[model samples]
Target chain A: MTESLQGARVVIGSIGDDIHVVGITILGHALRNAGAEVIQLGIQTPVEEFVATAVAEDADAVFVSSSNGHAAIFCDGVRGLMAAAGADDVLLYVGGNLANTAAADWSEVEARFLAMGFDRAYPSRTQPAQAISDLVADLAQRRSASNG
Target chain B: MADNVTNERLTDDAFHAQRETIFREQLGRAPYDLDEALAFSLENAKRGTVAAVLQKAKATGVAAVVPRAGVASWEGQRALMQMLDEAGAAYLPITIDSLTRELQFAEAERRLASSTTEVSALNGYPIVAHGIEANRRLIQSFDKPVIVRANAVDLRITAETGLASGGTAFVSGPMYATLEYSKNTPLSEGISKWQYIFRLMGIYSEAGVPMADDAVGFSQSGTCSVPALMHVGVILDALIMASQGVKHIMLYSMLQGNIAQDVASCLAVEQLATEYLHKLGLDDVSTYVASSDWNGAFPERRPDAYGLIAANVFAAAIARAPLNYVKTIDEGIGVPTAESNADSIRVTRYLMNLIGRQAHAWRTPEIEFELHLNLIQARAILDAIIDLGDGDPVVGSIKGIGTGILDIPFSPNIHVKGNVLPIRDASGAVRFLDHGALPIPAEALEMERERLSHRSADPSALGYQDVVDDLQFLELDTFDPATGTEVKA
Candidate 1:
């Protein structure tokens, strides 16, 4: 299962004023264990940084994480920026507390980010294994698509 | 290589020149003058400052209660302070907003003046946006001397604004600010920036102002079971400030749950800092200990939260910490309201009175062991750090932390992979399951393991979930003092 991401380059960070480091740091460690090259841009990252580093590192995916539900403030238009940087093939994923206090439904939060151009969105309380497995499958599918 | 930072004291010319930039360019106000500042300190000396209040608390043997407070509008902030003061706060805080802390004054100005809900509303008052005199008016409106609380990337400009606004003290020194507050900056740069901050405090001290500098672990590290090394951060914080000529040093330790260890952390910081400062030939500096109550999870119910507050108050009285940074019953929820903050102070005040009379049962072998253990853990690291910096804490911290000779990580708990925090031993006191990158002594490490082994009857078969139980330990521990076997309702 982990063979799909063997030596895959991934960029992960918590964007905006969200200084939630523990969750993302744990995710980075797990990704590293799964044979992925994880470039950690810790907390309070801007959108341009996620794009610039992904482009510079030639990363296969960019994972934007936030626990503050201020995603609408920072995560909006982020994938478009990555696209503008001419890296549209690079997968964009965001997770963790994507909705404000009023958000009662996880599906609605996921759909909001998907509309904002994220390939997928995970809600709060997501285990590290779930996100890792999704990334592994997504990378495998992308590899087949490119080869075909 | 770190740029534009140094351990050298700023010359008079350099300080004056820096002030021009700090007030005018940074704050959009007239330059701050040494004469006016000196005169202001002299003027305010009779009225009493935070240091004076703490000094009096020391003299009277009272553990004074203080609260953290700020809001967007001056009227709103003044009213909050007024309510807290009337509710019995010993000293107040001018908690600066996030934008001001990050040096985003223009944005803060726009947000403060803009009648729109356009940008996210700032979390606290904008001291710089309100300007010096405006802040002075709000501060002087209250009776007690205020402390400027901020987690700025560089506190030099913020300190200047805060001092000019009649704050008798500035909280969060270099080591505390950098490791705890800053996300990506190097330690040396924080050292360099805080050099200016201490020089500013030195300036006030030279002018006969009783200016105090506080060194608390600025990190949410207080939210978890902070290692014994957290006290080292406190001592090193004071060393960095004292080296820069700061006179009065205030050391803050957070309570991480265990009553004995929690109290020991504060005592260890005071005793160790005094000894080390004396070793450095800076013995004139007086050290005071202050303890902040739990920064961790609180039960959602207000009554339950009050029980937790009462437990911490008992801890403070036991430790005899001269000042206690109190927490509201709204800890498990969002930012506390003025009424809630006042309620916390009243509860703390009442408990201090009740607990002050009954404390003969507290001085036990457990407390002595915890205190001795705390000193041992902190000294081993400090000796290595000072030797690494060639006897200068300011230089040592920059070089030592940068080199990992002082192996505190981006998070203070450097050993925590996957963000797993330090877990507890059998007695519910947090002991490191893995020492990680911390340089705690070998015997202490053995003692910790031996203690932690008690959590399982068959110590060898302890499961992963057993260790992880500490995360939710406090949830059921609401009104922790009431957990005594005989005290159940």
Candidate 2:
């Protein structure tokens, strides 16, 4: 079965001061392959840049990746920034070494991100295929909810 | 003569005391009473030490397989170790959790406590958080020697605690930790901190403790193909450790896929390290070649991944690496289950035993050629680093890395230029595509260039795409030269 994210535009990048671009590059490639138009900001992307670019491009989603384990600290209030930029409806996802502590509870981490206004959160080592599939489903759900 | 005098001055008691004070302050905690820890460690040392096991393996001509493993709770880690021990693992590792590695002791404690009641969030054992007593219990629970594998920049506390708490060996080097692991940590700072660690090892050795200290080699760059750079780094670290009085040194080399090249790299590192240590008047230092199966990205396909894993096991065996860090079949697929971890060890043990029995028939001209080339190239790099440091490896390594004379590919350290690029030649042996500022001799550089030229019309065509392809080569079943697309086997 094929799930199409045909006209969906997404801004993808590694947020915070993290220069690890490998994960985000793979994520961007997977999103693109899944038929989404991905605008990758590369590594060490400031949260403001992600929000601004999403607003400018009218992107459907903003996905932030960080492998340096400081994603929570760097991504704080990023959801509020998107809201202030009037892009609150945009789907938000963050993943990759998301917390400094390796012993962090994924459910708690996911809850923390959800409370921070992210639509989805992935723990460390989440495969690209799984993230892509989740993105497709989330995008479809958001579209359906908006249509209703 | 001047270098020897400098070495003497550096080894003075007052100098070490001052350095220890600074290291203690950096530790941000009081130093654990070494006497207490050493007594306990010495008692455990009687049962079996990592050094003894390795020495026994060397004598028996058997490769001892050690798996890198850790979990949140003591029970979880114990269970994992027990599983590995039952699978014929000679030595096991208490791989520290990330929180502990980053010195978040409180966080690790909380996680460890919570993980017991709930599913653990930790990737490894939180030895620091668990403290000395708990670590000792964990070690005593396992019959095999337990080694500590951590990536902390300030390893003073970890070293003291691990050595005291029944950890038989600890692995780290300034260059390996700074360039391969930390981003903001300066090479000088890392070197100083590791100097303190080496001193701690020295104290244990002085007490006549059979402790093993490993100078992390190719595993640092983890898949980036710079055999000579890795060899130089390992040997330089060995010299520094020897200066600090570490008696048993394990020089590591990661497998690079090519069987002949991998075996040659292992042998070359062993020979170069021994030669350099002896030249530096460390003849009493016993050195061993430790092979890491593969520290890089692994194949996603199960069969292919197992194939690669088996290949590495064979390479380690044929190379006669006494210590082998076996990677699980579930590598590149996130943290492995206890079952998979044991399975990997079993496979490695089987391969090592089989190869040991049939060792005499394994020699070939290809192997000799690779070994010769590796030794020459590694020696050239080593000589350049020494010359750069003015005949002192400690000063030379710092200078070598400070200058771009020595470079590791994909290193995150800001000081690291990361200009050197590595690509596989036609025979799948890693060759320098762009030597960058690496100070290898002209003959070696020309030889590498000539080797790569045979693979592609434009030897310098190794751009970003080529590196990306090379990184993902194992995952791909076959390469279509024209389309550059991967075809599944």
Best by DockQ: 1
**Which residue runs does candidate 1 get wrong by more than 4 Å?**
A1-11, A17-20, A27-39, A51-148, B1-8, B20-30, B115-120, B217-227, B297-304, B409-421, B436-438, B456-489
TM-score (0 to 1) for chain A, all models?
0.95, 0.94
| Candidate 2 lDDT over residue span A51-76, tens digit each | 99999999998998876555655677
Model 2 alpha-carbon miss at residue B418, Å: 1.1
True contacts kept of 1: 0.05
Q: Residue B196 of candidate 1: its Cα lDDT?
A: 78
Question: B181, model 1: CA deviation in Å?
Answer: 2.3
Can you write out model 2's per-residue Cα lDDT over B72-161, one digit (the tens) per residue?
A: 888878887888889888888888766667666676777677776235566677787787888888899877888898875666666777
| Model 1 DockQ (Cα-based) | 0.15
lDDT of 2 at B57: 83
Name the docking class for model 2: incorrect
User: Candidate 2 — which pairs collide?
Assistant: A103-B121, B389-B396
DockQ of 2: 0.13
TM-score of 2: 0.82
Q: What residue pairs clash in candidate 1, if any at all?
A: none
